[model samples]
Target: MDLDFYKKQALQKQKEHKKFLDGLKKKPPKNLDYQVLETHEETFEEIDCLSCANCCKTTGPLYIEKDIERISKHLRMRQADFEAKFLRVDEDNDKVLQDLPCFFLNDDNTCSIYDVRPKACREYPHTDRKKIYQINNLTIKNTLICPATYVFVEKLRKALEK
Candidate 1:
């Protein structure tokens, strides 16, 4: 899928789409998780994340203590130094990146520290997980960031519409 095309489409439809997702959350189908898993699997098979790293480029994932430890160790930096240089405590009291376009994002839209990247980054888009209905708010927001998510939700909406 073309990034700009979906991005434009997402921008245009975000509000209505969010309402759709919210309603889905309120009255989730009995097979909600199964449908999401199937759609997510199919979406990811065709979409290459490297081609569109909008999640890494535009948003910062919450970095926990273990994420700090692993990433610091991988980068050969002291934990304190790493945190000081790259992180700040967000309003939610979560450790998030200090800047946008993520400091660790490479030019090719890959993560500079892929293996040691934060858990949230690894689980991004978060479409294929269990209890999918519980994260409707997040999934709605991700539609703006990830095209695959937009496609997944749109397809699922059609497949299981009430």
Candidate 2:
């Protein structure tokens, strides 16, 4: 995937997407969640996340207590030690990775701790969750970072229109 091209396209459509998403939030279709999940599934069929790990490369996942414990155990490290080594408190007071390109991201764009990755990482872009309309702002922001998100939103818009 040509990330630069997708990023440019997403940037250009930012305002339009935000507007559309806001409208979606106001009064989502009854089956909006279903459509979002369906769209998400189809979008991923064509776009491999390994080909574009911009989300991992550019953004850090919020590490909740359970995630910290799970990942720390998976790596055979003390939770406090793992936190001290790899995480920091963000402005939102959430524990997030200390650096970009995520400390656990291998050279091939695969997560080193794939099985025990953070909940936020497991739900990156978050387009397929229940109550999809509640997270319009996040979905809009993700369009800029994940090409699959961009495609999903565009496809969702079309699906909603008809």
Candidate 3:
């Protein structure tokens, strides 16, 4: 995928997308969730995450306590030690990774601890989540970092227009 091209397109369309999403938030369609879920499924069928792990490369997932515990256990370390070594609290007061490109991201773009990865990582882009209109802000941000999100939003707009 041409990331530079995608970035340019996303930046150009940012305001338009945000406007559409804001409108969607005020009066979403009855089938909004269903359409978004279907669109999410179709988008993933065409896009391969392994080919472009941009989200992992550019952003950090918010690690909650359960995620910390799970990952700590998976790595055979105490939770405190894991937090000290890999996590820092952000301004949002959420625990996030210390680095981008994710410490666990392997050379092949696969996660070293995929099974024990944080919940936020698992639900990234979040287009398929219920009441997606509620997450318009997150979706807008993801469009810059995730081509799948950009495509999904475009597909969803088309789907809704019909």
Best by lDDT: 3
What would the per-residue lDDT of candidate 3 be over residues 57-91, giving only the tens digit for each residue?
A: 98999999999999999999999999999999999
lDDT (Cα) of model 3: 0.91
Q: lDDT for model 2, on a 0 to 1 scale? A: 0.90
Candidate 3, number of clashes: 0
Computed on alpha carbons, the lDDT of every model, listed in order, comes to 0.87, 0.90, 0.91
TM-score of 3: 0.96
- Cα lDDT for residue 137, model 2? 82
Model 2: lDDT of residue 158: 92
Most TM-score-accurate candidate: 3
lDDT tens per residue, model 1, 80-159: 99999999999999999999999999998878899988999889989988877778778877887899998888887787
What is the overall TM-score of model 2 with all chains considered together?
0.95
lDDT of 1: 0.87
Clashes of each: 0, 0, 0
